[model samples]
Target: MFAVIRTGGKQYVVKPGDRIKVEKLEANVGDTIEISEVLLVNKEGEVKLGNPVVEGAKVVASVVDHAKGPKVIVFKKRAKKGYKRKKGHRQLITTIEIKEIL
Candidate 1:
């Protein structure tokens, strides 16, 4: 089965055993977390879509590791004024493996 779940202000489509990186979550590796904001679920052609979220539906996942997303650079410059600025950032992320959709 596959499910659409919301976490970290984003939505992801996942299935059992699938691994994905999501915005940082306060959990350690090997910890199991339940995503209760399930938007949709499909099982053997049977589908369930939530109005906002499916009532009583959840996706179970296990934290694989903590990670950091690729660095992003921001540069700014002003014409003849001789002004320039540069910045870089890396977003914190978490890797989780989908265990089941229920």
Candidate 2:
């Protein structure tokens, strides 16, 4: 079965044994996390879509690791005024392995 879930302001479609990287969460590696914001679920040939989220539907996953995304550079330049600015940022991320969708 597959499920569509929301976490940290983003939506992801995942299935059992799937590993996905999402925005940073509080749990540490090896911890089990329950995602209750399930938007849709497909089991066999049956599909269920929620009006936002499905009731009593959840996805169970385990935290596999924590890391950061690649750095993004931001550069701004002005015309003949000779003004320039540069910045770099990397977003914190967490990888989780989907165990089940219920």
Candidate 3:
């Protein structure tokens, strides 16, 4: 089965055995987390969509590792004015493996 879950202000469609990277969560590596904000579920060829979220529906996943995404550089410049600013950022991320949709 596959499910759509929301976490950290984002939504993800996931299925068992699928690995995905999401915003960092307050849990250790290998910890199992249940995401209850399931928006939709598809089992076999049957699809069920929720009104925002489905009651009693959940997605289970295990944290595989903690990681940092690649750095993103932001540069700003003003024409004819020697004004420039540069910044870099790396997002904290968690890699999780989907285990089930319930």
Best by TM-score: 2
Model 2 clash pairs are none
Supply every candidate's count of residue pairs whose N, Cα or C atoms clash at under 3 angstroms: 0, 0, 0
Regions more than 4 Å wrong, model 1? none
Q: What is the lDDT of residue 70 in candidate 3?
A: 96
TM-score of each: 0.95, 0.96, 0.95
Cα deviation of 8 in candidate 3 (Å)?
1.9
How much lDDT does each candidate structure score? 0.96, 0.97, 0.93
The predicted structure with the larger TM-score, 1 or 2, is 2
Candidate order by decreasing lDDT: 2, 1, 3
- Encode model 3's per-residue lDDT on 1-97: one tens digit a residue: 7888999899998999999999999999989999999999999989899998998998889999999999999999999999999999999999999
Q: In candidate 2, residue 28 scores what lDDT?
A: 84
Clashes of 3: 0
> TM-score-based ranking, best first?
2, 1, 3
- After superposition of all CA atoms, the RMSD between model 1 and the true structure is 0.8
Candidate 2 clash total? 0
